[model samples]
Every structure is written in C-alpha cells, then in structure tokens.
Target: MDKIGFIGLGIMGRPMAKNLIKAGYAVVVCDVNQQAVEELRACGAESAATPAETAEKAGTFIVTMLPNSPQVREVTAGENGLLKGIRAGQIVVDMSSISPIASRELDALLREKGAEMLDAPVSGGQEKAEQGTLAIMVGGSAAAFEKARPILEKMGATVTLVGESGAGQITKLVNQMIVGINISAVAEGMAFAKKAGVEPRRVFEAIRKGLAGSQCLEDKAPRMFEGRYDPGFRINLHIKDLWNVLETSRAVSCSVPLSGQVIEMMIALANEGHETKDHGSLGLYYEKLNNVALKEIQK
Candidate 1:
C-alpha cells in the first residue's frame, strides 16, 4: 500500500483516516486541530502541518474530507496548498461533500499541474464512518477510480465510480435532498403520533417494517424517541448540503421546493442554537411547532 495523505480531521475524517492506518497504510494527516493530529499520531500515523506538506510526504495519494468547496479550494490551491507539492501521476481523492461545480473546477486545476483528482463523497453518517462501512460515490477517470478503489474500500463498504469530474458530488446532492425531506416527514409524523396521544415508539414499531419504513426512519426515529440530539450528522452541515442542493438545482433548471421547506425548518432550529445538534433535531422542529416534546410525550 502507498503512503496516503489524509486531511481534515473532524468527526468523519478522523475515523476514516484511522481506518487507513489500521489497514497498514503509512498515513500522513493534516489538520488545524493539533489535538486530533496528536491523537492520530498516537495511533501510528505521521503528521504534516499543511496540505502541501502532506502531499510531499505521502507522494502517491492525498485524500481530503473537508467541510465544503471553499475549504477544499484553500487546501488545494491556496498558500502551502497541495498543488505546490503534488506531482504528475499523483492523485487527490476529495471525499468531502462539496459543490459538484467546484469539484470539476478543482479537478481542472489539478490537471493543469499534471496531477489528477477524484470527487469521492460518502454517506452513512458518523456511526458507519467509525465502522468503516460508508457508501462512497465517486466521479473521475475510470483508471484513477480503479487505482484508488483499494484505499477507498478501507473506509467504505461500497465504493462506486459514478461518472466523470462532478457526478459524485451531484449524486450526493440527490442523496441529501431525499434525506432532508425524509427526515422532515419522519419528524412531522412522529410529532403527529405524540399529539394524538399515541406512544411515538409504538407507532414507529407499527410502521417500521411496512412500506413506510426506511433507513432514515431506522437511524433517526430512535434518536427522536430518546431525544438524543448528539451529532451523528450535524444540523448545520445538513443545512450546508441542502443549500448546495438548491444552488445546483438552480444551475440545472430543476425545482426542489420540498428541500427548500426542510432547509427553512432546519434554519429555524439553527436560529434556536441547535445548529451543532444532530440532524434528527428536525424532530425537535415539529416538537416546537406542535408544542409537544417527543421524549416528554413518550413518558
């Protein structure tokens, strides 16, 4: 296995990088969080101070799981950026959920430097990230996808090459749109169950195995029942993804009114300082509107 440079050590990135290390890859990590860097170092990973430094040290592959397009741009093209150190034949696999347009532009920039880029975003939230069972959707050259499959498989159970340049990020936008809308629907239904004086858990159990059941229902309904708003995936980050969805939709002449509504509800919750809370807090939005709490009502 080649030495891999992994950047961005936040909730998803940290565990994904650790899995690469566990798989016997010589990993070099870069992050602004010194504590996260030290923690990974303790796990036998090397550390780099900047994206450029990481690229220089890791040589063949550099992977970034950053927050958004701006962050990805800065790390790849700004001062001490990866473009400075990436060589011809080196590939940068960006696993961040960012704008598909931006992903294409960045790929072009890397090509100018004789390097290649792959837009490979992932799903399955923090739990699956820790378990190394994420579903990765990739968009890039077929050859590059083949070369990077083993490395991606270390962090994801399903790795697929979807299309070229920007398709992976576009597919992720579709994923987020469905997720955001489904979460809102779940929230509304559970709140309705509570207001109707039925135990939300009972309703969930009654409907979970029927055609109404879904992965979102399975993952988030329990969190709603328990009122656990811990960050499996932050409301703030989901908001970012939805907003990107809207922007991309506008560019391609598509309508997403449902996503727009969910974004509004999430923003309402964010204004109440629940931005950093789990996205399952969409349930809390219904709770507030209906003047009932899911946890308290269940009790």
Candidate 2:
C-alpha cells in the first residue's frame, strides 16, 4: 500500500483524486485553491501546503492532473515545486494534456534529479472521472508504467502504455484531434437536420444506428438537443488541446488538414465567448450560423 500525492483538484482532478482515496489509497492532496484542498480534506485526504511537501510525504508516487503544460511546469519546477522534494526512484505521473516534447524535456530533467516521469493524459470528461472510467494513455519507461499501473487502474477503465516518454501525449493529441473534428461534424449534421425540416432528435435517432453514428454523437447530441451545455469538458480546454496538436504536428512535419480547420473553428467559437461552455456548445455556433434558435427546434 504505497502512499500517493495528488495535485490539482479542478473539475476532473478532484473526482479522479476522490476515486483514488475511495479505493483506499493514502492520498496526500494539494491545490492552489484552498476550497479544493478543503474538499479533499473532508473526503479523508491529507492536505499539503505545497507540491514539495506533498512529494515529501508521499515519497515516490505523485500524480498531477493539471490544466496545461505551464501549470505542470509550475508545480514540478517552481520554487516550492514537487521536484524540490522528489527523491531517487520516485515516479511523477502527469495526467494533464500537454505537448509530447514538453513531456520529454520534463522526463529528462526529472531523471537528472533521480526521479522518473510519465505522461498519462486522459480522456472521457468529468463524468468519466467521477465514474472512474476514464481512458488513460500513458507514455513512459516500462518500469515506470508498472509502478503506476495499479493506482491508475483505480481512476480509469482503459489504461494503455502507448510508448516511451511523451508517447502518451502524442496519443492524446490524436484523440483530441479526432474528437474536435467529430464534434464539429456532429454540430454541422444537427444543423443540417434542423434546416431541412427533419426533427433533430429523430435525425439523431436515425443516424445513430447507422454508419454515421459515433461516440461523440451518442454522448453530445442529446445534450445539444436539450441545450444543456454544462462544462463536462470546457470548450477552452479543447482549444488548448488543438493548439498543442498544431504545434506538435508542425514539429513532426505532419499535415492534419481536418485538425487545422477544427482548431480554427474552435478558436472562433472561443473568441465569441463560448470558452467556458461545454465543447458540445459548438452546436449553438452552428445553430446561430443557420439562424435557427434552439428553442425553435424544440417546438
């Protein structure tokens, strides 16, 4: 029963940490938000004053589910960061969506300090986080993956070791690219259905059982119909992921035409102030473009 340090208690982080605790892991928690720290404390977690302290208490296994690469750097390399306290043979598993190159650099830096790094970015949104059914894509040495697997199993349904040191981030970038493009296509399909005098829900029902169906359509189309754009996964986060994908693709000299277009559309939607909404709210952008109010469709 190894002790664990869990950092970053935002929408997905909080639930994932909770699952680890509920599975009987001794979790030491930290977050910049005092309220998030307090919530974890109430759930039987020990609160740490800083990432370094958390690392000191947990010793070898630390998990961070942060917002982005910069935040990841701040927690791991800042003055009071985790690296300041991490010792030899310790493992730092970063489950944040970040660049593979950044993960590779961090891996090298952490290794110099006698610690190992793993990029284990996740998918399936907040709902899956709460359910402990996330899809985790891991990239690290085989030994590090073995050390982290048991704990990761508590937080995800499908955990895969895609490759070594930054491969997980690459896989996650591919995941986001397909998700962004598919969700946009779903939005466009819904809009087409609405404009053509077909019942949007029926259109969803008809196509859902056909070749055009997808997990995105099944999970997000109903929410779009109900106008429930709650932030299971924020629109801005997808925009950030796309930005990472664009940069990663450029670095590899790869062309992702659909990914590029989807990124631009997400940027436009975010610029129009839908950043805080759910990614499914792209449907609203399509609705507006076609001059069809969501309420009108419900009638």
Candidate 3:
C-alpha cells in the first residue's frame, strides 16, 4: 500500500483517515488539532507537524477534508503549505466542500507543478464517514481518478468521477441545495403533523416507505422526533454550503427560490444559536413557527 498524507482531522476527516490506516495503508497525518493527530497516531498512523512535511513524507496521495474554500486554499497554498513540498506525479485529493471555481484554480496551480488534483467531496455526514460508507464525488482527469480509486474505495461505498475539474464541488453544492430544501420540507411537514394532532412517529412510519421517502427524511425525521440535535451535520456547515449554492447559481444566471427560502430558515436557526446543532433541528424552526414542539412520542 502507498503512503498517504491526510490533513484536516476533524469530525469527518479523523474517521476517514482511520479507515485508511485500518486498510493497511501507511498514513501520515497533519492537523492543527493536536489531539486528533495524536488519536490517529495512536491508531498506528504517523504524524507530521505541517502540510509541507506531510507532502514530503507521503508517497503519492494526499487527502484534505476541510471546512470551506478559504481553509482549503490556506492549507494548499499558504506559507508552509502542501504546495511547498508536493513533488511531480503526486495526486492531491481534496474532499472539502468548497467552490468549484476555487477547485479549478487550485488544480491549475497543482498542474503547473507537474502534480494533479482531484476535487473529491463527500456526503452521508459523520455517521457514514465513521462507517466508511460515504458517497464520494470526484472531478478531475480520468487517470487521476483511476489512481485514486483504490484509496477512495477504502473510505466510501460509492466513488464516482462526475466530470472534469471543479465538477465534484459543483455536484456537492447541488447535494447541499437539495439537502437543505429536503430538511426544511421534512421539518415543516412533521411539525405540521404534530400540530394537527397526529402522532409524528406514526406519520413517519406510514410515509417512510412511500413516495415521500428520502435519505434526508429517514435520517433527520427520527432525530427530530427524538429531540436529538447532535451534529451529524451542523446547521452552520449546511448554511455555508447553501451560501455557496446561491452564489454559484448567481454565477450561472440560475434561480433557486426554494434554496433561498431554506437558507433563510438556516440563518434563523443560526441566529438563535442552533448553528452547532444538527440540521435536523430545522424542525425547531418550524416548531417555533407553529408554536408546537417535536418530542418523542411512543412508538
């Protein structure tokens, strides 16, 4: 197995990197969070002090799972960045949810150094990340995709090369757009049902197998009913993705009214300090609107 350099060991990144180690790859990791790095180090992975050192030590593949475009850019191009030490023929797989435009610009930078970059973002949140069942979407050259496929497969159940440079990030934005909208719809509908004197759990059990079913509904509705708002995916992060959606839509002269509305709901939740809560707490938004709450009803 090739030596892998992993960066940004956060909620998603930490588990994904650990899966690579479990797959028998020699992994070197870097993160500002020393505890996370130490945790992976204790799991038989090596640790690096900086991205540049990580790049120099890794054999071919370097993966980054970060927050947004700014963080990704800083790690890849800032002083003491991976670009400082990345060599010819190296492949950088960025799994961060960022701007497609930024992905393209970074790809251009990597290409100029005789290296390749793949904009590979993922879905399925923290749960699937820990289970190594994320759905990864890649955008880059076919050759790079093939080279990275084995590494990706170890961490994702579904790894797809969607299109050329920046395409994966665009696809991620689409995912976020639909996810925000679906979460809002689920919250609104469930809250309405509860307010109308229907058992929210029964409503979920009834419609979950019907045409209204979705991954979002199945995952989030239960969280809503249980009143558990832990961060499978945080409201603030979804808000960030939604802002990217609206910005990209504007760039392409497209309109996304539903996304616009959902973003407002996210902003409202964030304003109320629910930003760190799971996006399933979108139910709280509707609950407040209707003056009703979603609590665990006996199944």
Candidate 4:
C-alpha cells in the first residue's frame, strides 16, 4: 500500500482521510486549516505544510477534496502546488464536485506532466464520508480506474468508473441537478401541506410510501419540519454546483429548465443570506412564499 497524499481536509475530506488512516494506509495530509491537519496527524497521519510538500513526501497517489473548480485549479498549479512536486506516473484523484470542463483542463495539465488524473467526485454527504460509504463517480482511463479502485473502495461504498476525463464531474453535476430539484420539490410539498393546515410530517409519511416517495423526502423532510438548517452540505455549495450545471448545460446546448428554476430559487435563498445553511433549508423559501411555517410533527 503506497502512502497517500491528502489535501483539503474540510468536512468531507477530514473523514475520508481518517478512513484511509484507519484502513492501514500511510496518509499524509495538507490543508489551509492547521487544526484539520493536526487532527489527521493525531490519527496517525503525517501532516504536510503544503500540497507540494505532501506530493513530495507521499507515494504515487494524491487525493484532493477541494471546494470548487478555481480552488482545485489553484492547488494543483500554484507555486507550492501538487504539480511542482509530482513525479511521472503519480495519480491525482479529485473528489470535489466541480466543472467537467475544468476537470478536463486539470486532466490535460496532469497528462502534460506525464501523470494520470481521475475526476472522482463523491456524493452521500459528510456523514457518508465519515462512514466510508460515499458514492464515488469516477472518470478516467480503465488503467487509472483499476489502479485507483482499491483506494477508492476504502472511502466509498459505490465506486464506478463512469467514463473518461470529465465524466465524473458531469455525473456530479447531474447529481446536483437532481438533488436541487428534489429538495425544491420537497420544500414545495411540505410548504403546501402546511399552508393547507395539514401536518407536513404526516404528509411526508403518507406520500413517502407512494409514487411521490424518495430519499430526498426521507432525509430532508424532518430537517425542514424541525427548522434545523445547519450545514451538512451547505446551500451555497449546491448553488455553486448548480452554477456548474448551468454552465456545462450551456456549453453543450442542453436545456435544463428545471435546474434553471431550482437555481433561481437557490439564488433567492442565498441572496437572503441563508446560503450557509443545509440545503434542506430550501423549505424556508417556500415558507416565505406560502406565508406559512411548517411545524414538526410528533414522531
């Protein structure tokens, strides 16, 4: 087992890195957050002062769980970046959900330096990251996928190589689109039920077993009912993902009408300064629209 260099130890990254450490891999970590790096270090992982340092000291694999396209681009290309210290044949697994176009650009940059890249964006949120049961969508060559699958399996429950180069990010954008749409639908339904003087949680239980049922309803409905809007996956991040979704849609001349509508609603929530809350907080937007507040139903 080669030593893995891990960067960007935020909510998702920290747990994934910890899982790697627990799985008996020698993991080296780097992040802007010193406490995050130190936390991993306490778990038997080595800490690097920078991405370049991690790449230099760690083995053939580097995993980055960054926030967005620009950050990913910067961390791999900046002065003390991954490319500065990478050797030929080393691989980069970017688990961030970002722009597919940007993923392709990063792939080209890595290939130019005689390295391989996999855009392996993950879903299933921070809790999944902690439990090592994330759903990882990978896009890269078959060889690279095979080489990376074992390491990926350690962090994800469902790992699949979907296509080449940018497919993983494209997949992630699709995931975000569905997520945004689903959350919005749940928000709308719960708000409507509350406005109609029906218990939204009871409505959730009734419809949850029918054709209207879905994981979104199951996972997010209670949160909306309880008015808990803490950031598991921040609404702002979903907004960013939708931005990528729309940008990529325009590039390919695809019409994402529902996605566009959801983005508009998300932007409304963000502009109102609710972007830092969990995406399930979308119900608030509907609550405002309906002029009704949803009360938590008795379990």
TM-score of each: 0.93, 0.93, 0.93, 0.94
Model 2 regions more than 4 Å off: 196-199, 293-296
What does candidate 1's lDDT look like per residue over 151-256, in tens digits? Answer: 9999999999999999999999999999899999899999999899998889999999999899999999999988898987899999999988988899999988
lDDT of 1 at 101: 85
Report the lDDT of model 3 for residue 235.
Answer: 91
Which residues of candidate 3, in runs, are more than 4 Å off?
Answer: 194-202, 296-299
Q: Count the backbone clashes (under 3 Å) in each candidate.
A: 0, 0, 0, 0
Clashes of 1: 0
lDDT of 2 by residue, 1-299 (tens): 78899999999899999999999898999999999999999999998999999999995799999989999999998989988998999999999999888899888989999898999999888889999999999999999998889999999999999999999999999888988899999989889888988878888888898888999999889998888988877889998998899888899999999988887777788889888898888888888889874433444
Q: What TM-score number comes out for model 1? A: 0.93
Residue 85 of model 4 has an lDDT of 92
Clash-forming residue pairs, model 1: none
lDDT of 2: 0.90
Clashing pairs in 2: none
How big is the positional error of residue 136 in model 1, measured in Å on the Cα after superposition?
0.9
| Residue 213 Cα positional deviation in candidate 3, in Å, after optimal superposition | 2.4
Clashing residue pairs, candidate 4?
Answer: none
- Local accuracy of candidate 4 as per-residue lDDT tens digits, 40-73: 9899998888888988988889999999999999
